[model samples]
Target: MVNSLSKRCISLLPIYKKVPWKSIVLHPIIHPRFKFTCWLAAWQRLATADRLLKIGVQVPLECSFCNNAMETVEHLFFDCSISKAIW
Candidate 1:
């Protein structure tokens, strides 16, 4: 006799939940925005004492979408024309 699909899935539940976070950290193609946001966050974090002091780098920075005006994290993620279409 064959087991139901739900039974098979349930059998793997414990193993699935036990998987470590490190197992997937290096896997590519997980999520495009996840990688991009991580890179952007790292860049912002590592900017510098001088760059942070600059008006442009501090806040209201140029939009990554158009590269023609000021950018905010919101604009980069959703408000910009190019990114809004993507979302």
Candidate 2:
């Protein structure tokens, strides 16, 4: 047990939650742009309007489709009713 614990190779395995990539992001025929979008969405790093506004971009900061909430990456992609409908 001590030998296995001391092996650097054994410590290199992933220790985080597994991403569900096979069914979603790994289809051979899926468009590359869509794959990149999925990767960005997973990280909540998409440059939505609200994020741009905070960074000094001059885009409108309201959800254009929802019209009532701040247009953030999370709001536009996860919490908006329109986004839910599309998903």
Candidate 3:
């Protein structure tokens, strides 16, 4: 009965696709903090200004480092000039 209940519970849970970056982001050798950060970024769940604004928090939309565009996971990691320089 327990086994059947567990299977039913699991079946009720949401399904997600296999993310391509999971292996790289969750490598055993990676630091836990960095791994969590990468996980949030990979899911586009990082609390960037744009995301904060969506939840009604008042914050400037500009990128803090480059001020060229809205702060977002993509801009912070790739599109921002300052981040590109640092990387």
- Compare the candidates by TM-score and give the number of the best one: 3
Error of 1 at 81 (Å): 0.7
Off by over 4 Å in 2: 1-17, 20-23
Q: Tell me each candidate's RMSD, in Å, in order.
A: 10.1, 4.4, 3.8
Stretches of candidate 3 off by over 4 Å are 1-16
Clashing pairs in 3: none
Clashes by residue pair, model 1: 61-71, 62-71
For residues 21-58, what per-residue lDDT tens digits would candidate 1 score against the true structure? 43354468668676555555445543333345464555
Model 2: lowest-lDDT 10 consecutive positions: 17-26
**lDDT tens string, model 2, 1-87?**
778777877788779877786468778888999988988877766888866777898987789898878887778777999989998
**For model 1, what is the alpha-carbon lDDT of residue 21?**
41
Mind sharing the TM-score for model 2?
Answer: 0.64
Each prediction's total of clashing residue pairs, residues at least 3 apart in sequence or on different chains, is 2, 0, 0
